[model samples]
Target chain A: MKGMTIIVKTISSWVKVLIFLFGIYIVLFGHLTPGGGFAGGVILASSYVLLMLAYGREFAEENLSLPVASKLDSVGALLFAAVALCGLCCGAAGFFFNFIQQRWFAGQDRAFDLVSAGTIPLSNIAIGLKVGASLFLIILVLSMFRPDTSTNEKE
Target chain B: MSVPLPVFVAVPLVTAFLLPIFGKKGKSAATFLANIATIALLVLAIASIGQSNVYKIGKWPIPLGINLVYDGLSSLMLLVISVVSAAAMFFSIRYMEQYTAKAKYLSLFLLMVAGMNGVVLSGDIFNLFVFLEIASLSSYALVGFGCQHEELEASFKYMVLGSIASVFILFGVALVYGNTGSLNMAYISQAIQKSGLNAGLGFALGLFITGFGLKAALVPFHAWLPDAHPSAPAPISAMLSGVLIKALGVYTLARVLFNVFGVTIPIGWILVVLGILSMVAGAFLAIGQWDFKRLLAYSSISQLGYITLGIGLGALIIARAGKDITAEQLAWASLAILGGLFHLANHAVYKSLLFLTSGSVEMATGTRQLKHLGGLAEKMPVTRATCTVASASIAGIPPFSGFWSKLILVIAAIQAGFYWVAAIIVFVSLCTLIMYLKVQRYVFLGELPENLQQTKENKGSMLVAMVFLACLCVLMGLLLVPGLRETILTPAVNVLTGGYSYSADVIKAAGGM
Candidate 1:
């Protein structure tokens, strides 16, 4: 597929980075704000989607290849699960116990800080990475199907 | 002994995500890792048996935070899911070799297992739905893994219907939350017990029945099963028929209806009627199928019918007798529940064995059409023998697992004063026998076809998996022995019989927080 018009491509190229940065902000500050990993992930994916729309599939694939995205997806999920498993070893606190919050802050003193919620930000980051890569891959794979022009032309 | 409940969901889940990183060159490594995960799960499930605990996630108290409830029923279900998954994973070691992207297949397989474990252990209704989606989405992908025309078509149909079921379930959950202000099962049950079944709650119950019934593929909601089950590869066929439906569909229905909402007369009869309908319809449909796996798939519906019938009969007895019920009625009710739970375990074993046998046959002969293959008894001795054992168990032949459960159901029906129910039970058994006889005749006993002349038995892990389940099919009847029954089956039965007290019991188990 050919690339879109110059204006569209230019605007998307400029806007995509901002979207990515905004997504990172949402993920990092997810504990205090409404937008968390999933929302941030969508924003991140949409940034790529915009690039794909403007530059075409090949350009986007060149930027973030399929294999890399796939690996990133797995890594993100593993990171989340690894974080959860870490809680299992922490002195009978149970799975997903927020041990860092309890040990460092002692009660709800750090409730309003950026890194206040123990493990939440980390989990959100992992989930954000997974959701972003997964959505990108889904859209990329779905876009692979094109009309069979030769068959249609023959008919 | 204190195997953490989260481990059941975590091991498979982490392994699922981890497998994809191995890529193409690491197929063998991925498979090995996946096998270890499932085996570890099976070991954990065994160790955790006869012990119950409520693990509050993040150590949050019940009613306010998510909890994983491990009780008699969950333990039983976890054991079944682990056994079938372990067998299926082992079988996939060789069986999935024909397909490309074996790592992805294994990943999806583990994902499905993780989802099922989550569903079984989840104490919160909405969390159960999330896990249900995870399992359903993966199974949908697995069903279409072949990516052939028919496989894709079947997967689409399955996904559409399954999504509809999920939507219904989610809507029901929302209604329940709106009505009771809680997503936790224990809290919801308590609220219902306190307020009785209001109109909204009753409607939510209706939605749950429709949703889970669709998931379970009970008669009216069974259009997707035959197509979806046979289209997948054999190990998947086994997993789908063996544990997926029971874990996602029937188990949820039983838990919600019996434990959460508290069974009433109308609801009890609704379940009984649905069970009977599924039994008669599924058996009749199955007997006519020429496709080996399709026949088994239809028979799965029939077998599931027997389970629902047992549970429904128990519910009806309890509902009719009510609080002033006599000891005899209570005994009958417990017997019915015992039959249902026992049949659930028995079916998971034999049905998965049956599907694995079919897979072996399909692999060896390149066809699942019964008519194209015959006289495999000579060529594939192991597959033939194991298939016969599974068929016998499923047909309720004496001394096998199926017989004991069927006997219990019949006795319960008769003692509960439902002679017609007993008759139908016998009738279904007869129909099941005929179907398997047809399978035996067409697939094993007849003249060897020219095309299938060079067929050979599948060996190694596939054979081992088949033989493992076949042995379980034969020995599962021992689970009914008085001493053994006290440990597994009785506690499960007590959970259902306990009814409204489930909330109290769960909260108490959670340290009364």
Candidate 2:
């Protein structure tokens, strides 16, 4: 598919970074806020979707690419699993036990702090990455099935 | 013996994510890793045969956090799932070679396995729904993995129906939670026992039955099974029919009904009616199918009917006896449950084995239509022998596994004074036998087709997988022996027959925190 109008392209390129940063903010502060991994991740993916709509499929793909997105997807899942496994292995607390909260952040007044919720924030980051990459990949793959009218028009 | 319950889910879940990273060139390595994951699950399931434990996720107490409750029924289901999965994975090693993107197939396969394990082990209602969706979604994708026109259509149909079933289940979960103020199954049961079933909870129960019934493909809700099961690749078809319906449908239904709702006469009779309808309809419809896999799919619906009938009969008796359940009544009820649970395990082995044989035949002869094939008993000796074994087992022939389970169901039906039910069970068995007879005569015993004269047996892993399950079919009846029965089957029966006592057991096992 071809790019949209130049105005749309110019506007999206500027707005995309802010949107991505906002997603990161939501993810990092997820443990304290209502919007956590899933919500934040969708926002992250939406930034990329914006770019795809403006600059077209090829440019969007060149920015993140299918392979990189796929790899990131797998990596995100592995990171989440790794965090859970660490909890299982490190402490006698059980699978998904918050070792970081118990051992490192035990006692004291870290409750409202940004770094307080132990594995929760880490898990949020992992889920954010996974959801972001997964949504991107899904849209990219679905875009591949778009009708070939653009190529035909060129011909 | 008390293996951590999460390992059952974790091993496969971790491996599934790790797999696709291997990409195209790493297909063999990915398959090897996937096989190892399934075999590990099998070993763990075997070690956990007679054990029960409750693992609380995140070290949280019951009612506050999700728990994995591994009891007799879970153990039994786990064993069946792992055995079938292990064999199916082995079979897929060679069978899935026909398809491209082998890594993605293996990944989806493991994810389905993980989801099933989670479903069987989950102690919380919402947790169960999440896992149920996981398993159902993967199966839908796998069904259309080949991307053929027919396969895609079947997958779409399956997906739409399955999503509706899931929505119904989620609504039920929400109702139960809203009424009881808890998502933990044990707490919900205890609350129900105390407050009893109000109108809302009663509605939830109905929703649960309809939802799980759809998942189980029980007669009225069984429109998707024939197309979906046949359209998938053979090993997947085996897994879908053999264990997926049992784990996601019947097992969850039984868990929710007996353990949570605590079984009333109305519900019991409802189950009986559904069971009888499925048995009669599935059998009549299956007898006329031309496609081999489609025939097996319909037969799966029929065999599943036997399990539902057995469980429903037991529930009816127990509900009738009420608080004054006598020794004899309890015996009859447990016997019926035994038959159902035993049939469940037996069906898992033989049905999957039968599907594998169909795969073998298809791989060799390039057709699943019985009309184009004949007299393969001469050429493919091993496939014929194993197929005969599975067929005999499924047809309720004596000394094979299916006979014992059927015998138990018949005896229980007679003892409980449900003579009509007993008659129907026997009649279905006869119909099952006739269908298999047609399969044998047309596919193996008749004159070989001209083009299929050079057809050869599938060697290596596929043969190994078929033989493994075939051996299990012959020996599974031994599980009914007194010593083995006490360990493996009896506990599962007790869990169902014990009714609301499940809450007491799970809470106590959770250390009453």
Candidate 3:
């Protein structure tokens, strides 16, 4: 029974990883397509939920503690804010104001590079990170209150 | 002048994320950091006033790249948002101790603030929707933070309604984009002005009114408010009633309707009708509530109605131009709007203070049902004192912030030839007074309950927070004085008065690049 449970948990974990990767793909392509940070992050968080459901609370907690996830969430928000702050400090007009007019990389003009989109790509990535972490943290914390069924059933 | 507009959103957004890291152990530290962030924002807001600047999100020029626009209106909103959030954050430092996930609560609170700030500053309609969702979603989760049956029920109800509102807004944005081929508000306004009023623009306007109205909890769409406001924790309640609704709903509505759509007569009348309905209905419903917070919540809807009426009336007068209305009439209408905006700011302070007082009372005696609460004045002096000031303000007693705004609104109504509306304002003021007196009589004036004999005042940060806001309630009336009025109120009014010129100003500030 223990071996079978371990195998099942591993398979579930792999599946979650796959789902998370797919969600990242969606988030990355969000600006150009339909899916953005919010939808993609939710998808990513749902993968964690699936793992928790398949393996149990303890399994999920061990891999993704609430504190750790929350910290990541904060960092993501900070990264996003920091990008905007850079715009502010650079005299770029205001927050989230992308001021980079052109790009010169490796002695070549890369004005149209994906990274050259200024605050758009940066904000998108930041939003993706913050949304994913926030959803994960919220889900994890809320799940901690799941009632003990055996005691209630016996009572 | 040099402040980046997006920092207003980014700072809180970053801090909100960083806040949860403190966990249970570093909750106090997190709280302090959050307070500092809000204070920083308050300074920035104050500094940014009277200045108009635009930041292109990715170094790209208008019509292609997203932007954050900062001007008189956005700065005013930023100031209100920061002030309310700071006070609420300060209150939560002590109030949230009873709850287990203190850090998580702070995180969510900051996220909501970040979202509101973004909504106010966003230059792009699609970006506004994104921020609106962020704020709405965070508030939904915070409302359900307690996870009790009532909290969850309210949260679920709020979430359903709120999500629907967001979808409406998103659909509106998509429609506008399809019609104008631009998402930038300035570009859209320019397009609308160039194209004239088309079916698509009119439909978009209707969708915006519905979406923002629901978000604002205007009379027709106010069902979720009474249930949702009183369900959250006291600080969250304060934020929601005090700043969240104004920032996410009223401010956005006014920005879009006035600056973006250029405020036609029909739209203005629609706003006035909505305002009158909310004012009369909300006040009447509030008078019957026994739940202390619920009464306050209902009152919020009513007060917001007055603000809408003032702005809408102003827009109507301006649209009519010269036939029956002069520029003075327009000014008078703005005076009404100024009153509404003033009331909005004042209400934020006093209402949050009231909620904090309610939280203190509930914390001490363990009940919020008015019948179960009585004569704790001697027991909880700080709370009783603050509650009295806040209640007096809400009741529109002379010398309080609420009175000045209500008086301005009434005066403006009468001057604008809307004598009945003026009379209604006075009548509603009386109704508000009666309801608050009932609160005072039931909760503070009567004999102390036997079960609450040992109830004591909340100390530390909670008392500090209550005192801070109470002091403001007494002093806020000074905002009408010449220097202060010129500095604060006039700038805000100018933004609205600038009308369609707003798009021109924004484009100009971008150096017409």
Tens digits of per-residue lDDT for model 3, B197-314: 7898889889999999999999999999999999999999999999888988899899999888887889879989999999999999999999999999999999888889888878
For every candidate, C-alpha RMSD to the true structure in Å: 1.2, 1.9, 3.7
Question: Each model's number of backbone clashes?
Answer: 0, 0, 11
Per-residue alpha-carbon lDDT of model 1 for B1-513, expressed as tens digits?
A: 689899999999999999999889999999999999999999999899889888999888878889999989998999999999999999999999999999999999999999999999999999999999999999999999999999999999999999999999999999999999999999999999899988988889999999999999999999999999999999999999999999999999999999899999998898899999999999999999999999999999999999999999999999999889999999999999899999999999999999999999999999999889899999999999999999999999998899999999999999999999999999999999999999999999989999888888888999999999999999999998889888888988898999988889889989755
Of 1 and 3, the candidate ranking higher by TM-score: 1
Scored against the true structure, residue A60 in model 1 reaches a CA lDDT of: 94
What TM value does model 2 have? 0.98
lDDT of 1 by residue, A1-155 (tens): 78899999999999999999999999988889899999999899999999999999999999999999999999999999988998998887788888788888885677779978888999999999999999999999999987669988888
- How far residue B446's Cα lies from its native spot in candidate 1, in Å, is 0.9
Residue B40 lDDT (model 3): 91
TM-score of chain A of each: 0.94, 0.93, 0.76
Model 1 chain B: ten consecutive residues of lowest lDDT: B504-513
| DockQ, prediction 3 | 0.51
Per-residue lDDT of model 2, residues B208-297, tens digit only = 999999999999999999999999999999999999999999999999999988988998899889988998899899999989999999
Worst 10 residues of 3 chain B by lDDT: B321-330
